[model samples]
Target: MLTPSVEALIQHLADGKFHSGKKLADTLQTSRTTVWKSVQSLQALGLEIQAVKGRGYRLTHPWERLNAEQITASIQVPEACPPPVVEVHDCLNSTNAHLLRTASLRPAASICLAEMQTAGRGRLGRNWVSPFGANIYLSLLWRFRRGESLGGLSLAVGVETVRVLRTLGLADLRLKWPNDILWQERKLGGILIEAITESQGQCVVVVGLGLNLRLPPGAADAIDQPWVDIRTILGGGSSRSDLAVPSRNRMAGDLSSRLLALLNAYGSEGLTPWLEDWRRWNCVLGRRVTVDEIGQRYEATAVNVTEEGSLVLRRDDGRRRLLAAGDVRLRVRHDA
Candidate 1:
């Protein structure tokens, strides 16, 4: 949680320049001791604050805070969809939870972004690691007057997200079945979709996304699976060394705009148009894998994904099964 004083201090130091404690205190109308304590708190939030006796304090690396204005400006609303309402927060428990709670009051294309999440979540109730100002934690609300099945919404979202990232020059990205983005078999990001239908046949959907821009060391320690961030990918190799890494604000704007465009396209055409794209990016297609469903594990050959985004598996006995939901894992040769 960021206090008002800390928020004020961050604004003053956001330029990546040194500001004396006395100067900050004077500007914020607080005591120097308070300024000192606030700086400590900022450092605790994974921000590298360099404190020198002569230079005072400044963020070690450039930190770009999320700007609602910049995000709004970057969005291009189509004639069929309403202009999005963008909101940025210093901290939130969960952006999806917030939108779900207030879905009835908000219109379509409503978006919420957070710098830090206290209770960030992923599919199947997994804890999403979110450090302050280090990654993208966003949720957007879309409404439909006539209810739609939304059977393949998550896969469509993944396809759009991959397209946006690839446009930004990140390579070797792939999509995992259901709701995951991967780079070289390691998780890079994920999508979570929540929906509720009203009695009148209107449905409201909340699409939540978490992408790792620069995961702090401590935050990465909590993740059980192998994962990678955009920074490491862009910073590696001769080919990508010249690529310019985008600021968080810019990335947010790009992602939001692309996602809105995707929503509009999906509304018109459904998941059929995106099925080929999803198949092209499917990382585990044709691999021997196991799907854990309700305490039973089904090991089979992944044949292909259905148009509705269900996994089509070929069992040992020449039987084919279409699974809607399960935890999927690649089966090694030793396991067979």
Candidate 2:
């Protein structure tokens, strides 16, 4: 396997410019043949590399290589879940599918991460692109205590996501109701939690996360809402561009460890302790929005997110309605 530095070098050279193999060898302090092998290794990872007579090699586009080992080293147990165990895949139909099949057989705290998901999905059965080397696609298996249902686990997850982004120095990040993370007003990421109830009413929750580290051409068109990628928020530039794109491995490691820790803390404190954090990063609150539940739509001024995570909205009729479970969509008029 190519070391992280070599992998970073591959991405750095992915820019359109022609980079000589000898130059790459010199930069990476490796033999020319070694550089050639590294290039071949990247090709297997789904990157398109071109080798011309004069031009050494160039990537057709950028790709992110997530680090699994780094993530494994960062797990800290704060909840009653199992010890962290990760399974990294080159491709899969869905991380959640894998978790669903293994939940009964496997212990909790098992994680599945894929380089690409052929059939990733979000709430409401929306298609999520799992492009090779584009972003973070992961599913974590957790078993909570029987009959222990936190009122606002989704909202708490959203708040924690913003905290993770802030830990990376990502600013202007906010949370939409339910479990969506936004950069300014553009959708940045989403969370989906699927719970399986056993015969005895025991529950196993599979939390799936999809984050756009980098967006490829045409992928953005599939998303109906306004969205942004990490590259866009950091500034439109290639990994080889002046700023360094953090290692996907480091990102995986840091995010997973921190997420597990948050879950542990949430297990004890519930959502109340994070109310202020959620409020600070709220994006849809106080906005005129449409809350959709069970095919019925209600338009109201986004008033607040209660301690229980239900959206508290003030309708035009001067009534306060607490939406239990619904699709909260920002009204077109509010954005206009």
Candidate 3:
């Protein structure tokens, strides 16, 4: 359960800086033995702690909370839309779920950020592993007029997210159709868009995003898919580029600024503006993939993706595209 003392201990070690045992004990108002026990509990949770005989203990990497002031300062908003206030929580069942319940009362671009999530979710009800202070878990509320075509909104969100990631010096990135952000064909992050249509031509959409920044060894054991994080991409020295992942606050701020700009444009322009980007980053196009839909499964070569968000497949029998809004799983094996 990570009692308050343990959480307090974490705040002290968050910046990748070592705190001596004596200092930690004094700060937490506990004895050295109790502080050591608390550190063990955190290690038990799969967080890597580097303890030296002389230097003390620190996290494997720096972790930062979602800072509201830093986020708003970095966001460049249009004159019409003020920077949405961020609701930062230490933990929540799901940022998306919480915003869905309250989006009706909030204006567009309202953001929800969390340090950790208990029941974080991805598309099609898969659990999104959310270890504390290790990744990005954000939900933003956007509304559209009832008649607006929501056809490619989810994919467009992916495009916007990838745009932000690219600006952050991420390379070899790809966008899987629907809502996945991929780096070298491995899942890096995802976008989930939930919509509620009212009786009076109003629609409320909650867009949730989860990106791995610094996942610990055992924290993501439940994830069935091959996942990659920002540190894994750049920090691993696999890439020759000098890119580095920014602090959590800056990452959140960059993502928020770009995504909000997207909501403002996507509502009116539809997917026309993002089609060019889709062609550049889509990993599904010209790739062999298996599609599972409603108990039927088939393999096909993806030929195209329409602006309406249809997946065009070239099968041995004939060419077809899926346009229905339902459970669609594209099992794409990485060969390219």
254-318, model 3: which lDDT tens digit per residue?
A: 88887888888877798889888987998888888888888999888888878787778888688
| Cα lDDT of model 2 by residue, 1-336, tens digit | 446755656766756467888888888877888888877876655556789877788876544455566678766555554588888887788999889977878776788899878789987678887777778887887777676756688777777677777777688898877778888678889888788887666688888888887766656667788888877777556555324445566677766766676666666677798889888888767788866666678678878877777778888999998876445444423561
Task: Give the alpha carbon lDDT tens digit for every residue of 118-223 in model 1.
Answer: 8999988899998898899999998765755577888999998998899888888988888899998788999999888966677888899999987878789989
Best lDDT goes to which candidate? 1
TM-score sort, best first? 1, 3, 2
TM-score for each candidate, following the candidate numbering: 0.91, 0.81, 0.91
Please estimate how well model 1 matches the true structure, expressed as its whole-model Cα lDDT: 0.84
Best first by lDDT, ranked: 1, 3, 2
lDDT of each: 0.84, 0.74, 0.83
Work out how many backbone clashes candidate 1 has.
0
All models, RMSD in angstroms: 2.8, 5.1, 2.6
Clashing pairs in 1: none
Cα displacement (angstroms), candidate 3, residue 325, comes to 5.1
